[model samples]
Target: MPGDGPRRGDAFEHDIQVGALRPAFEAAGLELVEIDWRAPLDDFEGLSLVLLGTAWDYQDHPREFVTRLEELGERGIIVCNPPPVVRWNAEKRYLRELERRGVAIVPTVWLDDAGHGDVAAAMNQFGTDRVVVKRQVGAGGLRQHSFSRDAMPDQDWRMGRPCMVQPFLPSVVEEGEYTFLFIDGEFSHGVLKRAAQGEYRIQSLYGGYETDFTPSAEDLAGAKAVVAALPFDDLLYCRIDMARLHSGELAVMEAEAIEPYLYPEQGPGLGERLAKAIVARL
Candidate 1:
């Protein structure tokens, strides 16, 4: 099996996700080869499973990147979560599609550019007293901001390029956000992510913290339904991030299919389970 790359640093040296999966792959008689996702297509041939590990640069060059992935797929390499699913889920626009399907989601507004018009009016539509402005395509909370109407500049309302605006749900300060992990469409484990004091974003790389969480039955049911409704069956892994709405409804914040942190440290046998799932598919 091939894992996606720039396989450097202590990111995986003590990483729970890597620690769990590596031994299991070895026991299952699979060679886990880590390759740079941007390397020549020849590097990906002969792989049984290809995971799009950590290469944020691929997002910047998605067209050329996915073209290479398509080539590999055409040659019969089983890319976990699939190239199509990765392409679709990479953008936050999928939230609109999910909302259309009756799944509850955080209130969101899409803007074309950072300077179109009427940011206040859009924020009002969501009844947001405060809101977050973020890039349409981003990771690690880069370039995201939380703002009250008074804090927004007049030029910030433009919509020339796609961007996102979401009501800054304050529940993040109390209950935090929950991320549920799934393997082969089944619940594996979960983590609770807390933004740093007085901050709204909950990415560990952005000063957020996480711990193992035991989800409620409702949480599990809602999460499973969301996964079931996704338009794919061959997914290898997924992370469903959720936060509670003011009215107490669970709302999806993000659905990560590519390169999401799995927090394998939370469970004793998670790595073996993931390995078995992949082996079963092979």
Candidate 2:
């Protein structure tokens, strides 16, 4: 698994992934090694597969990251989900592709940069008083902002980066966001991520917590649709995160095929499923 070695910022999540996946890979007769992604690519010469793991800092050096993956692929190393998939998923704009494929997504207004004027315009477009502005290429809720009509930003305030604006979904705090982990095009498990009080981001780093969740048939179908809409069919793993729309239907928040943490704590079989899928790819 390609990782950031020991100094990775998200140690807790890294441990969870390694603890669960290492043994499973062993039992499946595969030798799993964790290596720093930034380590010389030559270090991976004898490795057969490069499963993108907790290289969470790749967002800061996206170009370098993609080049590394491409180099690995050129060396005949099997890059699960492949380089093209990674390239497409590195930016959040891929959400637009899913929406174009007829999948429901949280209404979004794509912008080169977001200022107070853009925020107000978005609120009017969505008919919502509150809106969220998020970086076009970000994860873990970093650099995201929430503003209500009454709490508009100053004229000079700006996101100053490519961004997307969406109406704040009340169901995020009222119910919670749901994540469905799909292994090799099949549903493996579900998790409901609930943010702590006064927070709206459902990332564990922000004091969010997860619980085992069994999706309703309709909701599960909705998540399945997201997986189906993906352009590639050979993805070894996919994470579909959804939130309820005001109409009581689930809408796509993210179709993560990158290095998403497959909540093994919530789905005990995640390790085994991933290992088996890896083997199948070989």
* Candidate 2 residue-wise lDDT, 92-161, digit = tens: 8999999999999999999999999999999999999999999988888877999998999899998988
CA-only RMSD, every prediction: 3.1, 1.7
Q: Which portions of model 1 show Cα errors greater than 4 Å? A: 1-15, 154-160
Clashes per prediction?
Answer: 12, 0
Report, for every candidate in turn, its global Cα lDDT versus the true structure: 0.77, 0.90
- Best candidate (score: lDDT): 2
What are the TM-scores, per candidate, against the unseen true structure? 0.90, 0.96
Residue by residue across 76-150, what tens digits does model 1's lDDT show?
998877889888877888888888888888888787765524467667788776787776777667667777777
